[model samples]
Target: MTDRRYTLSKNERLCGKKNIQELFNEGSSFYFFPFKVYYSFNKNKTEGDHCALFTVPKRLFSKAVDRNLLKRKIKEAYRLNKPQFYNIPTSRPINIAYIYTARKMLNYSDIESSMIRCQKKLADNILNAQNDEEKN
Candidate 1:
């Protein structure tokens, strides 16, 4: 049986042009291999909320099928690994964008491993920021 918590629901999908623009403009970003991650901490949101955007640019992947396939793989990797990523206690939601930067295709295992590493780094950053805020 599949766990419902692992499912990527509509509420967890980042949407709206305003929200996307805000994330890119104000978010802190880091690159981890095939992905460039942009993340913004949302003070307006309640605790333990997070939303993610997965984008495989049309410029890199000319075909719709290729872009969709890559997006699917990335989303699956994230959905499975997200529980660990959210273990940090925070007062607000996180808005994250995972932009695919690789030119060549990668297998699922490769993507999943990268996702795990990326999540660790992201958690570190979030903790650091939280500590900084508390110190201030």
Candidate 2:
């Protein structure tokens, strides 16, 4: 699916225990509605770029089924809207984690729009970071 780069590939997912730990411990974070996005950027290179992890907190969602449902919705939203970040004019290879922070479960559309906003904000953040470096 060369034409469809939006497909969530294995490489495009935030894997490995080390990678995840680094993101959580040292990455920057921001909140967008039901999602709390934690991200780290490696601005030296663009290749091997942009991996994501979607999560539903077990503390808020007691049931496994409920957590799974939320994760699926979040994944779908990210997959559909990720192209916005893919085309960013920056050298950073971004690693992000989307953790569902809301206590109540929201339906698909709410999650989708929030995901869109999150991606847009990420793009803006990248642009701002680039601009900051230029000014420095």
Candidate 3:
């Protein structure tokens, strides 16, 4: 059987000042076509585990239904694509926040494609960062 690595929770989310600041200050980021990801390096967290924070602005999605729909799409995409991160060495927990930048809503296929691309970029970044650290 295949093991699952990524999971989202209320407390583990990047909600507070410290976590958010760390992500902005210490973490590296990757941007895909439709999503911008901000992630932070951690030394105390576990390997092969992740939590997500998603934002769908009211400015872009005026109605609650629209915002909720977008959020649901993003979450579903993340859920399916999260296993890709398992290949990276996870010494610490990484906090990832996916901010939607598109002006219009996207279909599931588009979201899924974007998410897969985003996850691959993130994995590449992590691998490169680790390699750099090892070389230094």
RMSD of each: 2.5, 2.1, 2.6
Candidate 2: residue 128 Cα off by (Å): 0.9
- Candidate 1 stretches greater than 4 Å from native: 1-4
For all predicted structures, in order, the TM-scores are 0.94, 0.90, 0.84
Winner by TM-score: 1
Question: Highest lDDT: which candidate?
Answer: 1
Q: 1-136, model 3: which lDDT tens digit per residue?
A: 1566455546545667777777778877767878888887754566535657888888988999998999999888887676666556655677888999899998999999988888888888877877887899
How would the candidate models be sorted by TM-score, starting from the highest?
Answer: 1, 2, 3
Q: How accurate is candidate 1 locally (lDDT)?
A: 0.89
Question: What does the lDDT read for residue 96 in candidate 2?
Answer: 89
Model 1 lDDT per residue over 1-136, tens place: 1224888989889989999999999999999998999998975677645999999988898999999998899999999998877777776889999999999889999999999999899999988988998999
Best of the two (1, 2) by lDDT: 1
Put down candidate 2 lDDT per residue, 34-98, tens digits, no spaces: 88999888543467658899998899999999999999999999898877767787666788899
Pairs that collide, model 1: none
